[model samples]
Target: MICVTLGRGRHRTLLEEWGQAAEAGAELVELRIDCLRSEINLKRLLTDRRTPIVFTVRRGADGGLWRGNEEKRLLLLREAIVTGVEYVDLELDIAKSIPRFGKTKRIVSYHNFRETPADLDTIAEQAREANADVVKIATMAKSVADASRILEAAARSSEKVPTVGIAMGPLGVFTRVLGRKFGAPFTFAGFNPERIFAPGMLQFDELRRDYGYERINAQTEVYAVLGDPIAHSLSPAVHNAAFQKLGINAVYVPLLIPNGKLRDSLDLLSWLDIKGMSVTIPHKEAILPMLRQADGAVDRLKACNTVVIKDKVWTGHNTDYHAAMGVLEEAYGGATSDEVSVLMDKQVLILGAGGVARTIAYGLSRRGAGVAITNRDDERAARVAAEVGCRHISWAARASTPCDILINGTPVGMHPNVDESPVPPAAFRAGMVVFDTIYHPENTMFLKLARERECRTISGVDMFVRQAALQFTLFTGKNAPDDLMRQVVARKLGVTRD
Candidate 1:
């Protein structure tokens, strides 16, 4: 069950949002009465309750806006309990002062915005001692270990008292989705996606639709996409949609693993029993040496974008190489046979010397395609060129050097940077193939300008969909629904069709 937290300044707005939450299939709604600007009218606000309510009056120290004194706040809380609200949240320190009244349940909670302390188990035990029907702990997670501690504590507490342990941030998002699996009664989410009352509070719709939270259980397998800036990733949306479509007992989540921390996080990831993962950006090349086994493509490119863990063996594969080659071959109507060499001897210039660019360069070179590499940082570009045995071009000379294909491996034309193109307008020529590896916006400015110049263009969406589909097959030993995958991504990207 997802508890939708509704905190509004006005009673009317709160009531309106409560109704909206109900329409959106909310089972429990938390009314943070502390957010009201005017005098509290408990009777008027609590009247006509559509769903069971968890009445909360949070103080400033606990990440709430209750500006009154402690006495007044306690009075409000006692009043709520006396009025027989379904539940009343009480801080661990103040829970004993107010005796239980009527049928209202007690939720003894602890909030620490600074960090998840070492004595989480002891703290939870203390909350349990407060006569709590449910023990709730919310803390900031500074590392993977911190998040793991929260989950472990929750699991232990659930054996005796129902617990909701949340590490409030991107790194700890797994706990929120996996709470039920660890015996948590439910997790908290906001009614509105834009209005966030707590740090890392998920939206109600996202929990129900994107994650399919209700289906997650102890037997459900876990998969995640790992990167530093993982919030923008569409992997969870696409993969979760596929899981629901195929009736697979699995949930895919986003994890924020900072650079140089992958090796340290292995134990925590293993503890969570993560069966598979989709690697991205900085981690792609760094994860190569850590893999127990890797495909030839991954070894050759020194990068791995897909991983499958079984029997403690970690194997890696490079879906980007195969996906890029597949799309390029399709664009040129190359012979079906791999031995025919469709891109044989074609001059290809790749932008950026990152993992994606390096992978494409090596793959093209193996297919008998002549490749040249260039970047704003000449040293990195020269390094990649030497590694692939290809020529290196200066960034300023990119447009002058003639090539049959131009690939934008850089992040220049990605979403939010949509107006910026890796190559100048003069670089695009008629009949040349232009490919940009940014998928959020299907028709990037790079692809749009290439079309205007009469150049054959390929949107990053093709490669993204193809690559994700390959990952899907590897994670689940079944063929992916390719059309459904494309539709899910298109819908998430807000793409409209004719």
Candidate 2:
């Protein structure tokens, strides 16, 4: 169940927002009376309301705006309870002072702004001792491990009392969605973006449609795309739609794994019994050494984008190789042999020396194409070129060198940097084909310049969708809905399909 929070400043606005929340399919609404500047008719607010309401007048220390005296705050809560509300939220500090109302469930909540303490069980036990009908444990998550600890605490505490566990922050978003699976009776979501009251809060529509909040169960398999700067990824929208289309009991979330923490994060995945994961950005190459076994594509590219855990062993695979190659083949459409021969003789220039650049270089080299690599860091560029048996072109000489195909393997013109281009506009020629690996901004500056020069262009959307489809197959052992994946990605990127 998704509980929508209403914290508008005016009573009239609050009532209006409540109706909106109800229309949005919210079964419950939380009214933060602390946000009101003046007193409201609590009886009128509850009258003729079909949805259940949870009344809360949070204080300043508890991350609320209530500035009244403790006596007045307690009076307000008591008044709300007498009005026949379904639930009353009280801080754990005042739980002992306030007696439970008849049939009005009491939720003793604890909010920690610092960190998830080492003794969560002890705190939860204290709430249970207070005779709370529901226990809410909310804490600031410093890392993925911190979120995991909170979930573990919830699973343990649920056996005693109904527990609502939440880890607040961007890193804690996974726990917010997966908390229900761990035994949370209901989870909270903002009715809209302007009404969000907590960090890492998602909208109800996103929770319901994109994350499969209502459909997720303890037995549902979990998969995710791991990256540091993951806000720009469309994997969740694309993969979740495919899961719904195929009726797969699975969910794909974005896991923000910071640098040097991959090894530690894998332990959490094992603990949660996550079925599989799709690696991205810096972790693509970093995850190779940690896997028990790897496919030939991963061995050849020296990178892994898909990891499937079977019988507690992790096997890595690289879908980017074939997915990328297939896109290039479609662009150079003709007979299969004719396309290969055309690619083999063409001079292909690739920019950047990261995991993606390495994958493209390896795949192109294996197809007998003459691949030249350049990067801002000469050492890394030389290393990738040497590994791929290709020549490393100096960055200063990229614009002057002529090539039939140019690929922006770097994230120069990705979202939020849409104005920046890796290659200069003057470098583009009339006949060259330009491809950028950044898919967030469908038509990047690099692609725009290529289009102006009458050069053929391919957006990164094709490669992203194709690779994710391949990862889906590896995760579920079912054929993915390719067209649905493409449609979802295009919609997410605000691109018009032909």
Candidate 3:
């Protein structure tokens, strides 16, 4: 439905313009009092409107021109509510402060004027708390990338709350078109240039006819990657691209679930008809206990990389285990017989024990590799080792003896930390193989030390591609276009293939 915003100081011409817009098929009027002088009256507009009205007195923090005092803002908002405008645009921050507003449906909003927040989960948390009729997030967008991040966040719980994503720049133009795909109820468009209310806003006709966005449907399938600081994920890009290629009508997105809400957040997928999800980062392990059931590698490894809902039942598995192992084995000279033997022996030294450890240990154990786990956090190292029935050693004890193979499962030697190897040169032995699971730097000090010792050395880039290839397979259910997937992952990771 069309809602023509009344410009500031346009009070003298409001009634006549409203009639013209209505005649042109605008369905309702939106009074943007934030753009108007304080003297312009909501009571007067309510008195004249035969059509319903939505009133908003947005603050400057929210990309609005409202420079008025907080007391004055609240006063105006209260007046609009008391007068009972059909809808009132209220910042979710202020709306949740009071027990209630008068009869109007509140279009509660969130805005990020700075660079997009690393976590969209926090934004969703704010919306969950606001309890508004709808939730809106406007992020200052510098590229289609930034816009996509916001659109992805809105996609996570569209059925729960009709969300709005306002991308405020030229790169943000795609937002209006993609908004519908993500269940965004409406997009902000400008009628004129100087008076353009938002950045990258287009005219309503342009949005309707040119962009071709439509109302969200109840049957649309949902999917997303849940994590904290989740704004930069490319699963939406990769998965959505795959969907378009395969002609799947499904949509995949990203959601920030904060640290504590992994269960409540992923539950949105089940409640909203989400068929599948791409889990990442901290959420990967945290989401383990939330699944209705987990089988296959997930049952043994106790880590799940993919969760699929069938007949409303959530089934989980760790595709990453085989993926990463396959990649590492393929890259490390097609995997030595000893490497194959280590998984069953429980004698391999794993230098890092984070999420990747889940895949590494699980994969190696399945292959009969004996694993030993260690980390900076001794307790965490112990936990991982105990779970896999591998022995644990302190970081200081790394030089004690040569294990069958030393795997760098941590990011100590990654790009920014390229100089920091988890294991020192003294930790290397001439006969042992070393695997540094840091893909970005290509080779870490650990791998270099192993190389200098004339020992077998392998890079982490292989493991990354292998894990991603598995995800690609699970996502498409077809053999991952191996060459294409490899190129895609290599190019994206700035790594070259074997």
TM-score per prediction, in order, is 0.96, 0.94, 0.56
Candidate 1 residue 221 C-alpha distance from true site, Å: 0.8
Q: What's the lDDT for all of these models?
A: 0.90, 0.86, 0.66
Q: For candidate 2, lDDT tens digit of each residue in 346-431?
A: 78999999878888888888888889999999999999899889999999988888998899999898877889999888889998
lDDT of 3 by residue, 1-498 (tens): 435566655665666666665675566667677776647666676777756777887777776788768997888777778877788787867877644556788788877776667677578667767877778787787543566577677777576787877665654554554567667655565443356776556566544433233332445456666666665444554555455455556566555555776775444334346677767677777767768898677877766778877777777878667766665455445656654532345357777778787568767766777667778889999988777766778877877756877887877876666677776677887777677777666667778878998888777655655565566566557554445544544554552222
Q: Score residue 352 of candidate 1 by CA lDDT.
A: 93
Candidate 3 — which residues are off by over 4 angstroms? Answer: 1-61, 64-178, 182-221, 244-247, 269-272, 328-347, 377-380, 426-432, 440-458, 494-498
Estimate the TM-score for candidate 1.
0.96
Q: List the residue pairs that clash in candidate 2.
A: none
Q: Model 2 misses residue 72 by how many Å?
A: 1.0
The full ranking of all candidates by lDDT, starting with the best, is 1, 2, 3
Q: What TM-score would candidate 2 get against the native? A: 0.94
The local distance difference test score of model 1 is: 0.90
Q: Give the TM-score (vs. native) of candidate 3.
A: 0.56
Task: Decide which is better by TM-score, 1 or 3.
Answer: 1
